[model samples]
Target: MKSIDPTIVKKKTLIYIPKLNRRQRTIVSTVFAAMLLLAIILGGLLISNERITTNLEIRNLSPSLEHPFGTDWLGRDMFARTIKGLTLSLGVGITAAAFSVLIALALGMLAATMGKRIDALISWLIDLFLSVPHLVSLILIAFTLGGGVKGVVVGVALTHWPSLARVIRAEVMQLRSAEFVGISRQFGKASWWIATRHIFPHLIPQFFVGLVLLFPHAVLHEAAVTFLGFGLSPQQPAIGIILSESMKYLSTGMWWLAFFPGLALLIMVRSFDILGDNLHMLIDPHRGHE
Candidate 1:
């Protein structure tokens, strides 16, 4: 037998490793690290009443050794408010995205598996939703529904599903005609069984990608709606509410109240967006190559 070249083998191994570009690596690291730190901070806040209370002094004290984020105009501890707001914003974004993804998955699966009439109806509904401006529709829905966190979540979820539905529908349509799906059908498996077992596995990566991508949008939408005075109540410590309140004090030189929260929000949104892009690349390396 001819001797195999060790150098060529090493080159082949390197080729198979799927090296991430600089941006991809940075995104992955930033997202993973931020998520971990955020989780730790949130947990600490939830568990430590003293720590939480200590941060909630209601005065616009500038950033000092005692008050890191400075006090809000209401003298509420900016640090506590920030931590609380971060938790709320993350909760809203994740919950809304999850609900939207579930809606999309169910509707998309149904459309792909059912008859032409069902598919047509679903398609029409999706088109109708896509035609409307998502943010405007979210605001309108939230306002109509009494304007609170629940309303904002529901509104964001409802408006967010159509695009995800289209993606899921396309994935299902492709899988429905595939060999494995045909094999499942030939084995006398129920449609739901085949969908749940075989099809869903393939769909999950895409679904996850969609979920991550939806996160930044959901967060931004929540902030925007709240800032416009139609989502979260003014009493809530949401970043948008903080920013909105800061407008009056802009001339008074109390800039840290808005600046730190806004910075935190920006970091979070950017982190999630980068994370989504990295996840897409990791899940579909071929797309990265292109």
Candidate 2:
């Protein structure tokens, strides 16, 4: 065989693979993050029930070969309890986020498309909600609703919508002046028909991204209220309850009770926050170049 010339070998080494565009990279990253999140959620769901089973014989054990997160005072596996509580929290977060997004969409559209009086009223309401401290409002709402899963859900749903609704309102206002919207109106299409057919499609990305971004807030608030005895029931295996129970045992030198559960919750919350930020960058027309 003939030996390749040195120059030809150098040229071959210079061949290039095209880099991914901003959109393509965002798509890949988003999918990977989503898959990881789903895997964690599914794992938590699968092992949650099994881990909560109690055994008095093994109660108050420290971390060992048999138990990584140690045992609670009641002999329940801390790892199992943490995972189960996380799953419960994730469920609450998702439900609350969905409800909040729906509220945002409706109010956003109304504020953008309706008369000036309605617009000003919605704007004032948004400002009013934003002015209050988030946790305090959530506690009050949750308590008023009877302080359980329903209370938490309603509280979160009510509190999380204002920011996203404001964003949607701005987007709809822009859409109102677009050429297509004006043409549709000239054709005698009713306001609702034009909104449904012309404006709503453009808002789907904002809606979805807003929904995801609301999740971490919902989860955190749910935990906070529950920890304060104003959210989920104490008997339920929720992150808030787990952390709340851990507080009493921490002074007894049983550090694992709070450490594992709180760490897991922190990880889950941060993961969702990163996921939401990534999604916002992906969906926003002006972002994701970096």
Candidate 3:
């Protein structure tokens, strides 16, 4: 019988490991381009010395050179307000998503890697939270906490963690029985050391995709709560507040007041969603195949 060469087998196996190629590169490039363009526009607005003064004469004006995004009912510069609102929305979305994911990661890891009773308790809590209607729970929390930006942030962060926790729990559970985890256990490696050294690297891609997906939802939820009068104050210039105020002028045919803001919100949400999808595909080639 011929002796099999182990080195040759190892080399062949390693050669088959998937990696990003030209098509993946193109997709990543496109996504980055969109994000970069958005960043540039937002940065310019943030740093520009030019003030956007509100003019009553231009109030509710349609999109034109003088007022690119048109003017709001309050005579505020809609273009400037939209930029500022986008910044605020992005800030809240990123911060809330990050906080929620961190909470989820910590809780989920504990549940997956800790004692059985502890896991059971955390799992039960997660299930209980999931059973509640997220939006309604957020609204109640915001109202109880005294409605404003801070209230909205807390409410959204609290409501957002369950889904991420479930995802992380599922990932951890799948990983716990894998060969590497079992080997680490047999070697008496500390749980935290094994998790950090072996598990976290695997979890990072999924976590990032989750983070991106969370962004759009967080922004939308914040806007919705604000629109319903349980979130940011109207004077703060949030997109939701703008939309809420625009409702009164709808019957009067000042459609631009609502139209532009609504369009801006839709565009932003869609961008984030697309970015998330692209990221998911990039990070998981199996997903790309689908």
Candidate 4:
């Protein structure tokens, strides 16, 4: 046989696409995550409670085209119930995480900008909270508040701030020693003026990313405490309540009851986590390189 150039007689290859740059990747992820979250929350909330109302005639139905997630033993549509519960969970997460991020921002700035005594006290409090198990403190706080929506949201807000506070505090401490801040201080600028004009602007991205990151934790904790009966009431369409009730039927081969709701919750949490990560990368481009 005549010899042929190996490069000219190339083998076929599978399809290939170029890798995305950091900005491109971030935009894609952020858009997808934001849309997915928004659609789910809006779709879930827009559905009336009537969809999940009892209908004994359809009780204990399995998954079908009519009832995508099947019907609970009470004949309620599991899909509607899951969506409603997810909406409630989203509310709890948003409220709790916002409060938590605000608390973190305030305490962190104070600890870094204020004198040593204030820093010591705030640091001690941070350490104290960090030393305790999060779930333990959350359960205690929720129980002390009497175990309802208020209790759960408050508990999550209070318990989730310490770690984020520490991060913010360190960031502020570093920012305080920056050349521009020192020059501003030398130019007779007040702490508040410098913070608002310089430091606060820088911290905004951190605050937002921290807030997004906190959502998953808040949602998961709310569901956990509620499932343990230390959070929302059983009558409410809470994810915890749905899962808790499903447990009683799982043994009777009612797998869909638990499986679908649990899966939805997982997807919701994971989506927030993805959104947070993408936002962080967008805010801090250096992280994306890693």
The lDDT values for all models are 0.83, 0.89, 0.81, 0.92
Q: How do all the candidates rank in terms of TM-score, highest first? A: 4, 2, 3, 1
- Between prediction 1 and prediction 3, the one with superior lDDT is 1
Per-candidate Cα RMSD to the true structure, in Å, reads: 8.0, 3.8, 11.6, 3.0
Taking all chains together, the TM-score of candidate 3 against the true structure is 0.84
| TM-scores for candidates 1 onward, in order | 0.82, 0.88, 0.84, 0.92
**Pairs clashing within candidate 1:** 58-75, 58-76, 59-75
Question: What does the lDDT read for residue 125 in candidate 2?
Answer: 95
- Residues 48-115 of candidate 2 have per-residue lDDT tens digits of 46567878989999988788889998889888888778888999999999999999999999998888
Order the candidate numbers by lDDT, best to worst.
4, 2, 1, 3
> After TM-score superposition, what is the CA distance of residue 211 in candidate 2 from its true location, in Å?
0.9
Error of 2 at 78 (Å): 1.0
How displaced is residue 146 in candidate 4, in Å? 1.0
**Candidate 1 regions with alpha-carbon error over 4 angstroms:** 1-58, 285-290
> Which is the winner by TM-score between candidate 2 and candidate 4?
4
Model 4 worst lDDT window (10 residues) = 7-16
What would you estimate as the lDDT of candidate 4? 0.92
Off by over 4 Å in 4: 1-18, 288-290
